[model samples]
Target: MADERETRPQADRQLCGLVRDLASQIEAHLRTRAATLGLTPTQATALCELTHPMTLRELADRMSCEPSNITFVADRLEGQGYLERHPHPDDRRAKQLLLTPEGSELRGRLVELLSKDSPLAPLATEEQDGLRHLLTRALIR
Candidate 1:
């Protein structure tokens, strides 16, 4: 009763700290991995998430950024010949971003690098799954 209430705040603060530390480690890992492929973390993330052609608006939604932000990413990728923008078939007002062949190859290598030496590499498969489930459950609440 009173005992539980007294510890709950401390427990929550500790959990929040742990989560932040983990997030920092993961971001560092992503930065390192993306650098190996000559990409910024955001660019690498965009490339990896582009399984199919999508408009800037859609990419922004996936990357959790504003559509304007995605334009900069798309411009850099397009300049490097990693992707191209074509008029959207369904939307006359929007353009779809498609990965070039080179982009696909780069993304494959990027994925491989990202899969190795992950911040959570120490966790076993079941532990990772459990953590993911818990995180997902928490997010929904």
Candidate 2:
């Protein structure tokens, strides 16, 4: 039998592998960056969740984190001028999280930084569209 590298399309496999590595690297890089913005990744995610002003419990569920963990993230974000916690008008004892103007601006900048074009931009566009179509068809059942 041939060596594994010679047995298959090595370039294609390497490209896919590199894409996964790049994604991991991006996550780590952004995690560090969140600090420069006075937020942790969890806090940033919580603020992003607040575009809809959900309750702490609901935000915890959406963020797949424990309620206490959500509260900690929210508290930090709130202290950092990135979020506001207000009484839920419908439930005076419950609190809802909302993004402050600064948080919105930060989220926008984070999105922009994460979405900058790469040398693989053209191929990625075609591949991403194809993947989205295929995944949508597969998952929409």
Candidate 3:
């Protein structure tokens, strides 16, 4: 029991480090693609996530951010004609965000760019599947 507890912290630290490294690589790749389309990483993320119209609060929740932050992103996107704010059907004072045609086109391009190559391109298909399974299982736990 003592040995298990002692090794657990080390194992956690290693796992965290690996995850951070992988995230950094993925972020860098995404940032490059976003820049080509004149978008900040957050803006690109927002565009990709808005597959359907959603309230500002819902978007904020999905992005794991504050509502005010989402409002700022939405304002910028609206100014760029990439999105629009429409009155929510159920709430007189609330609004929902919908991507414009331009936004959808750009989002499609962004998806293409992001999907061009896997970050783990060096790994075989089987290895990639195994890694994905392991990661999913860990996340579920």
List per-prediction Cα lDDT, in the order shown.
0.94, 0.74, 0.91
lDDT of 3 by residue, 12-98 (tens): 999999989998988898899899999999998898889899999999888899999989999999999999999999998999999
The lDDT, on a scale of 0 to 1, for candidate 1 is: 0.94
lDDT of 1 by residue, 10-80 (tens): 99999999999999998899999999888999999999889999999899999999999999999999999
| lDDT tens readout by residue for model 2, 1-141 | 477668578876886687688767756766766667666777756755666788989999988878998888888878878789888989999988888898788878766654554333445678978966865775585
TM-score of 3: 0.84
Screening candidate 3 with a backbone cut-off below 3 angstroms (N, C-alpha, C), the clashing residue pairs are none
Report the alpha-carbon TM-score of model 1 versus the true structure: 0.94
After superposing all C-alphas onto the true structure, candidate 2 shows an RMSD in angstroms of 5.1
- What TM-score, computed on C-alpha atoms, does each candidate reach? 0.94, 0.64, 0.84
Model 3 worst lDDT window (10 residues): 114-123
**Better-scoring candidate (lDDT), 1 or 3:** 1
Best by TM-score: 1
Off by over 4 Å in 2: 1-23, 117-126, 129-141
